[model samples]
Target chain A: MDLLAGIFTDYTLRNVALGAALLGLVGGVLGSFATLRRQSLLGDVLAHAALPGICLAFLLTGTKAPLILLLGAGLAGWLASLLMLAILRSTRLPEDSTLGVILSGFFGFGIGLLTFIQHSGDSDQAGLDKFIFGQAATVVGEDVLTMAVLGGVALLLVGLLYKEFKLLTFDPAFASSLGLPVRGLGTLLTSLTVIAVMIGLQTVGVVLMAAMLIAPAAAARQWTNRLSTMVWLSAAFGVLSGVLGAVISATRENLPTGPLVVLTASLITLFSLLLAPERGLVWDWRRTRNNRRRIRLERLLLDAHVLYNHAELTPESLAQRRRAAPARAKEELEELAARGWVTGRGERWELTEQGHAEAHRLEQAMRVLPKALNPRAEGGAGGAA
Target chain B: MSSDFVIVLTAIFVSTASALLGSFLVLRRMALMADAISHAVLPGIVLAFWVSGGERATAPALLGAAAAGLLTVTLVEWLTRTGRIKNDAAIGLVFPALFSLGVLAVSLYFRNVHLDLDAVLYGEIAYAPFNTLEAFGLNLGPESLWIMGGLTLVNLLFVLLFYKELKLSTFDAGLAAALGFLPAVLHYALMSLVSLTAVGAFQSVGAILIVAFLIIPPATAYLLTQRLPVMIALAVLVGAVSSVLGYVLAILLDASIAGMMATVAGLLFGLAWLFSPVGGVLTARNRRERQRREFAARLLLAHLAHHDRPVPAREVLEEFGWSPAFLAQAQQWAQREGLLAGDPNGLRLTARGAALAGERP
Candidate 1:
């Protein structure tokens, strides 16, 4: 308890926690759209694409202000997206390939610029390196305020455009038919994603922001069917993971905040994949096991009913005729007796009044031959022999 | 000028490799795999650096990047085959995890090391002149050029050797499977080539430029042509041109050469997207205009046919509110197409014209 108290009191811990929470809120809300559109990988591409923008911004203005860098990042990120779209539309190349090309190319350029900036030896470039892997500890009060405003704006935008986003995501053709201006709506959504990724860039950095965007929404998908519920749940999971990761990272020195946050989100996704009620592995396993058990019981009952068709056969004779193990045959007979479908006197067992009705029902259910178990026919055959 | 020539040559070599591989990637719809491979290979690079103990080492780094690239493809394939997750989700899950691992490895092992993430993301293409290789008594400064050249040759050979197989498999993978050819093997081979190209290109242009090279040129080529062979050829040309122009632009502005190159590639795609004669922005707009004109002409022709009168041109103009010039142009087109006949009295549909209108209805 004391150790926990000591860990929580640190200024770095507070800042990281606040920053991650904000990033989580934004990522979760935006990621729902990405997942729905089946463009989840776009998040990864955009995150990497932001690097060149940051490098360029710093190189041009020689300013390390977060706002300036972010604006530059946003512009570059947007351009990358445009290029991706252009490639897909103009070429016979698939959308994924186009995306791949833009993502790597832009990111590579960013890295080159960043390396140049580093080698130039500018003192003001102090915290600029943090954007690569992210340093939650570096989040100042002003940065937190910025995150809040940006996160709040993102949520508000999503709320305002919720209906259009849904229509556009589910069926663009239908949305267009309804005169909803699908292209405009698509641009709006992409813009929102870009903003969300940019906001996350401060805490998770470019390397791991995509994971934060995708993992929480993926995790939330397992828990619910409704879009609204999924969105809210994803938001909650994102915030929870972010806070948890921050706290974990705070407990130690030298642990990068981005990986911790990603790890936490990944854990939530892993949990959802394994344990969500309707679609989880455990539930599926239980369902299959129960189905197999039911099939086995039904098969045993059909066999027992066939035996009962022979006139008052002794338990021993019935077991021997079926070539059944005595103990196993006795268990089946006991189960039938417990259900009042059979009665026993000493070692002999026979179908009772209710038992006979059930036995006939079993025959009808199994569609087996009724005369196959007739003792009189068997006796006549034996006498002829 | 010599530097510009080299840059252009480099672009041609890289684009040739990227375009050849990109054709299959586009057909398979695994274009994002190339992106994933590029990012996920960082660890391999870091590992290569770590194994060689510095950035000066090239062979180990290349080997490491290749290994990482292969691992990424294998992992993605495994996750998809497990049926536990969707393909996009699988890609989303794998690359970041690996990337994060790479980042973490770099930070943990090389805390005091001079290397930074910037170097990993952006390579020093301007400084690429410093690195040279001697092959069979020939001096090739900028070893990346040779590496990319070798990979391009290998890619060309592979594609030529398996052209028929690749075409059949890409167009109809199920049929290919039924015919006893291994589509999965072809897919893996394509992925391997993408990885090799990405890693080879990464040194000179950095990761982002490599990506731009892989996607933009092919996309531009795709807009201009429908045939795969033609697309590949055109894409290579576009890539080479962009690289040359971008290098010049970079020199003029003193900007990052790779970034400028990517920008040029983007510009090319944008232009192609708008101006390509085959289903581009202009084409689509023209198609719409043509349809509107056809509709207006058909409406006028139908009105005349229904009335069985010498309909006044003024009356048709009043009903449609179209420009006189447009109406005249439409009439001329209709007449040329044999959809209408005109005498001094008025315009009427021929039997053929009536049949054409009726068929649409």
Candidate 2:
């Protein structure tokens, strides 16, 4: 309870939560475009390649200011993306391989440079290594301010060009024919992604920042089909997960904030995958079951109609015709009778006029289904099946 | 042997083993999976050690790591099979969770142990020479050398014995299955081989940049060559050179050997990307230019063959709207080939040029 109270009133906790939330919002908005384009791993590549930039920033500036470091990291990440695009255009190697090579190559160089700095006897190069997995607990007021200002600008850009980006994501060739600079817009979008990743690097680190960028967007994808809804939902989910992760970590003695936030986002993804209304697994399973029942009921009605048109039909004969058990046939007859489609079900069953009409429609549908399926069997031979 | 010799030899073996396994992985388009498997094997190593009553160096840990590799592949395949996520996203999801689990375990349960995270990231190859192998009371250089040598041998044998199967499965799994060959088996075997190599190389290159040795050398070779055998050979050569050069650079700068090696590998890949002779960017453009010039020359010769009247060179350029450079190069090439003779203001096709233009493929 005190933790909850601290979340509302505590200065440090509030700042950390706000910073995390700001990053989450922008990451979520950008990740929708990324996930839709099947370029989710671009986040991972950019984050890993930013390590060298961070080290370079500190080495040159001799200061560990968050904004300066992020500027360096963002520029490095942008350069990596450009190099990646060049390799793809120039070579036949797939994007995945190019991403892996740049990620490790740049990161390895960063580590080498960092080790040199450590050995150079600079005492203040202490917390620079935390970019590996992030340490969100170390976030301060100035850091939050930096994140909000940068992230706000990015979000505003996304809002201003939402329709253009939407067209760009769905169809690039069409956008190009309409006189849009497809490649330039693509580079701009990539630059925005780099900025968003840079904003979250200090709090989430390199390894898990990829998760933050992807998981929220992926989770929101399950509940939506429209691009606008997806972007907003993703941003909402990202903020909630970030703030909750921060507050929860604050409760523990020494739990890592970054991974915990990622874990929370991941849990949200798992739930959305299984529980969302339209695309969720639970909904799909229920839909399939209902469809099965409807199909079986129609089959029983058609079989009963063919057995003995206007006369009463015995359940045993109906079962024989259906190749099903007698008890199962009797229950199906009872269900039809209960629904007023048939009447007087027992050892014998009689079809109502509605039931007879339904059976005829189903019989006609079954006859046309084969002809529709086999286009070669068009014309008067539709009933041959 | 001197310690420096042992260090370089160990590095060579490590690079060769990884580069060989990585060749198949890269060709199969599973380069990032090596990175995932490398990270995912951490918990497997830790569990194997903890389960075997604190036995530091043994076979169970290796077995556990191999199991982890197979498990990583299985889980990734399973996740992708669910049809909810993509292959890269599935890879992104699985590795970090497992790697983070491994990290949390180290911090929670094994804090008192010597499994430092730094060693996991940047391996201390400097101490590898000190851990000498002992057999029959005679020292056998670094233990890493023997392990990596055996690994390279195993990989070589696997490639030699199953060369046909690997090739067929990699190129066309459906056809392999139609011919009663099990592509899945070869895939699992390759995964196990990659896992074992990754575990063995960990002491030399650490977990992070194993992807570098696994990818960069083979990728560079891929850019330079088209044949698989030659590609593999070139990858091994690249790896060896990168190892030797990186060792020298690292010794000079007193930096991590693995990092320097990775940087060197990246540099080599960059060079191959820019300057490979076979269909590389630089060469491909040049080839296109040459083909265009030859084609223009043929067109000019054919044009001359159609007319007995003297035609001004200026007319050809104005008629075709060809670039001045292209027209001049075409005329010069035709003249040199004896296809066309240039007069003061016009060109004419010779008898040979007429005969050549008369023939059609």
Candidate 3:
């Protein structure tokens, strides 16, 4: 309870939580577009590419201020994006290979710069490596303010150009036909993504920031298909993971906030993937099972109706007709009897008047459902065996 | 041997080994899969380190890392099979979570272990020489050099033995499967080799440099060559060159050798991107210009022949949507070749130009 109170009373804890929330907000908002566009790894590339910029910024300014370092990181990330685009257009290398090249090349150059700085005997390089494995504990009120401003700008731009981005994401060729500046919108969106990545760099670190951008959005995607709802839900999941993870790490002695937050988001992603209502794996499995059961019930009902005139309806005969076990047929009969579609005593059974009606309806439905479902109705001989 | 020689040799072996598989990776467009495996194998390495009680059990470590790599591939495939996410997003999701788990494990539990996070990303290749491999109380030079050299030899054999299957499946998996080659088995085999190489190289060159050596050299060679064998050969050559150059540059600059190696590899790729004779950026532009001139020349000739009269240059420009300058260039080329004899504003097709147009028209 004191840890809970610490969140509200302690300045450092409040700042860390706020910083995480800010990173979550911008990352989730922009990440929806990234996942939708199938450029999910772009965040990874931008984050890795920002390292050189951070080192260069420190080299030039001789300070480790959050705003200056982040600005430099953002510019370097932006430059990397531009270079990526140029390479994509001018070369035949596939996008994955190109992204791999930019990510590692820029990171290696940054590492070289970092080691150079370290060998140069600079004592102030201490805090700069924190950007790698982000020390959220070091986040102060000023850093929170920087995150808020940067994240706010990115969010505002997303709000203003929401429709254009939506159109661009779904159908850029159609957008071009509509006389939209598709390329300009795309570049702007990519730049916004760069901003989002930059904001998360100080909070989640370089290697794990990709999770912040991807996991929340991917988790939210399992919940909804609508763009607007996806963006909001994604942002909410991000915030939830961010705050929860920050609070947990704050209370714990040895936990790192960045990986903790990522792990939390991943758990949420796993949960959503398995248990969401429509698209979740569990739900899908249940749906398939239910569908199969329904089909079996319908087939059993039709079989009983077909055999009613020829032979006395018995569990033995029904089992033979369904190629199912006698025990299973008896169980299905009990279910149908409970539904008032069958009347039975001992081993014998007969269809009720309601059962006859349902069977007839099922027959007609089977014959016509295919025509209803298939517009072309190529093979019109639809009937139950 | 001097530490400098050991370091350079280690870099060369690691680079060559990675570049060999990197050729197939680039062709398969699974370059980032190497990145994923490199990061995801951390926990496996860590666990193996703990379970084996030391780092001396390299086999267990490699096995654990390979298993982890395969698990990563499986999880990604499972996620993509769910149809909720794409292959790329699935990849993005699975690796970081596993990597985070690995990082948290390293930081929380394995403090005394030699596996620090910095070494995970920026491997101490410069210090690799000091960790000498001793077999039967005899000094056997750097362990990294031996491990990487063995990895390079194993990759070379894998490629040579499976050359036919790899080539067929890479270019046309459908046909390879139709021919009963079982492309799926080949794919897993390739991924396993990649994982083994990644784990072997991870301790020396680090993760990002592994990506660089795996991707940039093969990618650069790809821009220069069209055949698989040539691409592989060229990639190894480029990797070797980059290692040597990167070592010298790192020494001169007093920087991270691995980082300088990747930077040098990037420089080579940049040069190849700009200057390769096959589909180089500048060559593509020149080819586009020449093709445009030839095409415009044909269109004009065909138009003149069809009309059977000299058409106004302005009319030709308007009809074909060509800019005035482009039209002038095409007309001047045609006239200089004696394919057309006309004033500045008129265009007439000569016999040879008409024959050229008729041959294609």
By DockQ, the best candidate is: 3
Query: What are the lDDT figures for the candidates, one per model?
Result: 0.76, 0.81, 0.86
Better of 2 and 3 by lDDT: 3
Q: Residue B45 in model 3: shift from native, Å?
A: 0.9
Residue A55, model 2, lDDT: 88
Off by over 4 Å in 2: A9-11, A282-385, B53-57, B112-115, B125-141, B286-361
lDDT (10s digit) by residue, model 2, range B86-109: 888777767766666666566556
True contacts kept of each: 0.47, 0.41, 0.82
Candidate 1 residue runs with Cα over 4 Å from true position: A1-8, A45-94, A97-137, A157-189, A251-254, A282-385, B1-8, B48-63, B78-84, B113-115, B125-142, B286-320, B324-361
- lDDT by residue (B133-249, candidate 1, tens digit) is 222111333465778789999999999999988988998999999998898888788788888788887765566676677777877777778888888788878888887887787
For model 2, residues A236-256, the per-residue Cα lDDT tens digits are 999988888889878865566
Tens-digit per-residue lDDT, A130-168, candidate 1:
787787778877787777887788789899989889888
**Which lDDT tens digits does candidate 3 get at residues B1-361?**
7778887888899999999899999999999888899888888887787687754567887888888999998899889887999998999999999988877877677555323466567776322211233321113337777889899999999999999999999999999999999999999998998888888888667777888999999999999999888999999999999999998998898888889999999989989998899989988888889898977876777788887767887788788888999888888888787788785557888888788778853
Residue B199 of candidate 3: its Cα lDDT?
86
The per-residue C-alpha lDDT of model 1 at residue A57 equals: 91
How are the candidates ranked when ordered by lDDT, highest leading? 3, 2, 1
Q: Give the higher-TM-score candidate: 2 or 3.
A: 3
Residue B189 lDDT in candidate 2: 91
DockQ, ranked from best to worst: 3, 2, 1
